[model samples]
Target: MDDGTRLGQADHAAGPRPPGVIFTMRYPSDVGFVWKTIALHRDLIARAFGGEARCILAYPQLSPTSAYQPRWSTAIQADFYDYSAENRQRLERVITDEAIRLVVFMSAQPADVDLGFLRGLGLRTVTSENNSYDHSLRQPFMKRLAKALIRRVLKRQVFDLHIANSQAQYDFLRGFAQLPASRLRAVRNGVDTDHFQPGERTGACSTLGLDPDRLWIMAASQARPEKRLERVLEVIRAVKDARPALPIGFFFVGEGENLAEWRQIALGLPDAETYRFFGRQNDLRPYYQAASVFIHGAFRESFGLVIAEAMASGLPVVATHAHGPAEIIAEGETGRLVGRDDWEGLGKAVIEYLDDAELRRTHGLAGRARCVALFSITRQAQEFADLLRPFLKDGAGAPY
Candidate 1:
């Protein structure tokens, strides 16, 4: 918990020089939860190599890329996504001409980056994710067979280290994926403490146009099926059915495939007028500050970053007691934990926070303190950089 002193004392630069080019993808600058993380730590990664960082972003689609993108200069057209011959050529040309060294894979998901090109780097490339998803259904028998043959494309030797944010990811990779624990390390995900602190509910409600008198709960993640939106709807439905007069507000932040369906469900709610869906927000501070509780029902979430953000904003959480949530939310300290697929249990927990101000305050305070102590990015990056110390010497970073 006392990670500040540890960060202050650790010699983060006591490691060896990097092998070469550092590769990563660009995320939209305004997607607060995920983008804010890179925006906060981009400099630390750059400084790790003394500004020798050469990164290639698959940024054809995103806008306002890399808010505080590092100070190093390289020679290449600031290209977009790599689906075409021209785009692929621009990327390959940059890699070949620059003699790129290492690749740094963040954001966990491999939706953007070129997995093959990074493998060709031959130096060391590492990837880190907040948590792991249940990709068991993603591959079929033929896909698995193909992956077994071409899986060399994803060989670990190319990536010297695969860092995870919580024990859930660590155990999944070790037990199911069969990755060596020595090659993978678990670190806590962080939050922007300065921005996401506890604030007066009055000011927040006034600014965000939320009713200060109503009991509001929020779930701030992409509205995907895996996020388990049905449970939230069911819980609110139960609470509203029993206590029809209860003034409650439900807010969903971010967007995804099930958004239209979720909106339909929201419209049928008893307090449909109070329900709010803010799509693809770049800033969630106001939402966190204004809400009474943050609830999550994801069947399999990676690390639950928004939970920490909410805690940092001094909001109580009521998350299901599953893999990722088990690690982030202490049973009674940060918020209540209920069973998954149990709408009654989740609803009762929601009602508990709604009615008890003292309980919410106690849990919210603990969450904020925990976030400040354990989930700070400075601590995460420092511990992670320690693991990369042994792999940096082969870097061939030429700025092409």
Candidate 2:
């Protein structure tokens, strides 16, 4: 790795320079978690390499001069879908100009990007798998066929490496996709512990117009059918019915195709007044900090980023025993994990935390500690640096 002084120095005038890296994804809205995660990874990678390794963001829809600049040193507008000769030449120009050696697809799929074209540039490429393939196959016919086709095409693509966000995904790629083990890696998603730490609820409550006296249970994720948010609503209703006088509220953040439907369902519940749906929040720290406990109802999450974020925010997690949550939550120490769709068990766990303030405090602190030790963004950066180091070329100021 380059020292601080060397990092600040200009590139050498002679010989081919050490290559940099570009993380590519669909330039979707800034409100979602995918973009935020990619930005954090880029920032940490640059920091890990002592600012020697240049990190850039490339997206199909992002404008070169967009008003909303991404949080990176450099960004380029390169369309992956437009496979015209002109687009290819433009992308080649970007690779040469930026000395890009590695292309890591953070959110874009093989179908979205031309993997063969990227490999032909003599660049090492990586694809990060963030979804559960098994669960995807369980979708309706058309959706399942689309997912299967993507998986088939992904298997045929000649990429340098494949990263799975969770161990279950790694297994799927290894067994179901039949990818070589040498080219596969399981890197669990991480959270920025510094940004999502324990904080006083007063400011968050005041800002969101939440009652400070009422205990809140929070769930922050896209309201997709696979998320099983209806299960969470059922639990909330059950809890309220059991404890009619308990001053408890449910704070739901994020919007999706099913968000409006879920909102309507929540309104039908007897404790409808206790539920608040703040759709698609740009910042989720306040909601996490203000909540007493965090619940996730996803039936099969490859890697529950929200669960890690909730743990980092010093909120005890009551999540389904899905792949990611099973790995993140330390059963008795940090939080509780019930079987998927086990509304009764989930409610019981929520009640356990709500009824005892001391238990909540102990578990919340433990969860935060676990996040710092195992799931911090800094740790993730180090892991990625180790993986990418061997592939980086040797040159002056290179992170090798």
Candidate 3:
């Protein structure tokens, strides 16, 4: 991995433009949320720094699911297969070559990489933790202890700034990681309200081959153990048991390893014939528009991005009282929040929305107003700029 040359060699050969920001995430999946965050905020970050700001992106691999071609800035593929001295030296080339002023490490996994080296190069540093309730935080004593120790060790390297996706995440960093409050900032994840807003329901369900007239409930999340999608199936079954005569359908979007298991569970339930699985999708607006209610069964999240999107789309949401959702959902207003493990409560909430059309409309309208007022991408971008203002002076760097 070594080119056998010092960092200065690459810097000497670089262009005359001011060193811009470089965001490092080992894997940059095209359809993944992190990539979407970069895409949404890149231009705004650049504008905040300077009109001529150039943002460079570095990642280990492109996701196979989405064809992610970078249109806004330069992309560097820095393979992190081996975190050896040679690889570290080679990775530094991307930084030196681009003359990056500030380096934002997007994931907590790689934040410890080249710490002293980055400091020596006078590169401003920032790190972000996106998971509010990490699954390991719920593991058994020995495993949890081991993870805590590992996390503590990995985060020994301090940053100029720390970004938390939600207040819960911000609290986790301060409490568990002992990150200073001065360095921590909680910026809730925002949605593209315009793209995900309410629309005509005429073809919304039919386009997915679903009966538009029947009541449809939608849940979108990666089908994973921690997400508790199985509980969603249980909620569906419980709802059916409680309301036998109600004609209802369930629609699930997004895909993961647990998707097959969820599908199998969905197949065996009563009225299971109405279960619709629209695997990983690039467009989710139609699903949100067609649904009578939006349901989220995840036990935890860094920030409930999908919940905000659903609200923006004017759908009444029923989600578990997970870390992010507990903070996001306005109970009995925009949506309802049940205990994370309460399947019956989840079912009851769903049924309430199903039985009453007036309830759905009232909650949906309120949710939309709340989402638009509080969680727009433009608002988040500005918050980022405010947080990053101090660092972007004369020759300071950009945040990711």
* Top lDDT prediction, candidate number: 2
Predicted candidate 3 versus true structure: per-residue lDDT over 1-400, tens digit per residue = 1332223345345546665677665455466533464455554555555544566655665454543445555555565333588777765676676566677766554344666777777778876667556633533677645555554455444577888878888887766665656667888778888888898775887777888778988988777787888878788877877888888889898888999998898888877779989887766888899899999988678787889989999999999888888777899999999887888888999999999999999999999999988888778867876776666467544342
Model 3 pairs whose backbones collide: none
Error of 3 at 74 (Å): 3.8
- Highest TM-score, which number? 2
Q: Which ten residues in a row have the lowest lDDT in candidate 2?
A: 1-10
Q: Give the C-alpha lDDT of model 2.
A: 0.75
lDDT of 2 at 375: 87
Ranking by lDDT: 2, 3, 1
Error of 2 at 87 (Å): 3.3
Better of 1 and 2 by lDDT: 2
Q: After superposition, how far is residue 251 of candidate 2 from its true place, in Å?
A: 1.3
Worst 10 residues of 3 by lDDT: 1-10
What TM-score fits each model? 0.80, 0.85, 0.84
Model 2 bad stretches (over 4 Å): 1-17, 32-34, 63-72, 81-86, 107-109, 135-155, 394-400
| Model 1: lDDT of residue 279 | 83
Among all windows of 10 consecutive residues in model 1, the one with the lowest summed lDDT is 1-10
